[model samples]
Target: AQSVTQPDARVTVSEGASLQLRCKYSYSATPYLFWYVQYPRQGLQLLLKYYSGDPVVQGVNGFEAEFSKSNSSFHLRKASVHWSDSAVYFCAVSAGNTGNYKYVFGAGTRLKVIA
Candidate 1:
């Protein structure tokens, strides 16, 4: 079985500060990793995803993630954050065959950006 874990339930960062949200996974094989952000009352927005090829994947709004196979981790990073970046971020993993893929989501990390 595949599972994803976000160690921090909540993270606070100052505006314009750098941020890194940790995400770890447990899977026998390399699974598809994704980072999604959810704004208040809004749907989950895809921040970044890593399926293959590059270990680092760029996402929208200056977001990016790096997939570490050895560490079984996919961590999200932003050089600088804004007030709009404050949201609940979720790390998810998709495993199984092409059509039989199953997604396991993390508990999510709520980010609070203060001035």
Candidate 2:
């Protein structure tokens, strides 16, 4: 069994500041790590994925994450965040099952950017 967790339920940040979101996972085998962002009611967009080699994975919209095997964590970071970046971020994990596999999503961290 594989699972993902995001500790923070909400984060408030000033616009143009550095930001980071936490993630942790529990999996017996190597799992596919992913970060997704949801603007409102739309489907989640893949920010990045960590499957095999690289520990540090680069993502879209000026975001990146580091995969730590020992800690079982994959945390997302952004050097500078915009007002538009204020949204719900979800961490997900999937076992390598291609046939009708499902991704477990975090509760979500609502990022509120203040001006």
Candidate 3:
């Protein structure tokens, strides 16, 4: 079984500050990792994803994530965050066995960027 965990329920940062959202997962095998952002009253959008290749993947805007197989962690980072970056971010994991896949999501971290 695979599961995702986001320890931070909410985070507040001043505009232009750097931001990092923590994500951890547990799975028996290699897992597909993803980060999604949901704006107020809007659907979730993919920020980034990792399946293979580089351990670090570039996402939309200035967002990026680093995957650590040893630590079973995938953390999201932004160089500078704007007020528009205020949203709920979710970390998801997908691992399959025998053609049956399991997708699990974290509780989500609500980010509030203050001007």
Tens digits of per-residue lDDT, candidate 1, 55-92, equal: 99999999999999999999999999999999999999
Candidate 2 residues 4-111, lDDT tens each?
889999999998899989999988777889999999888888999999898999989889999999999999999988999989999999987654388888888999
For all candidates in order, the CA lDDT equals 0.94, 0.91, 0.94
Clash tally, candidates in order? 0, 0, 0
Which of 1 and 3 is ahead in TM-score?
1
Q: Deviation in angstroms for 112 in model 3?
A: 0.4
Question: How many pairs in model 1 have backbone atoms within 3 A of each other, for residues 3 or more apart or on separate chains, i.e. clashes?
Answer: 0
Indicate whether candidate 1 or candidate 2 has the larger lDDT.
1
State the local distance difference test value for candidate 2: 0.91
Candidate 3 per-residue lDDT over residues 1-115, each given as its tens digit = 7889999999999999999999999988889999999998999999999998899999998999999999999999999999999999999998844364767999999999998
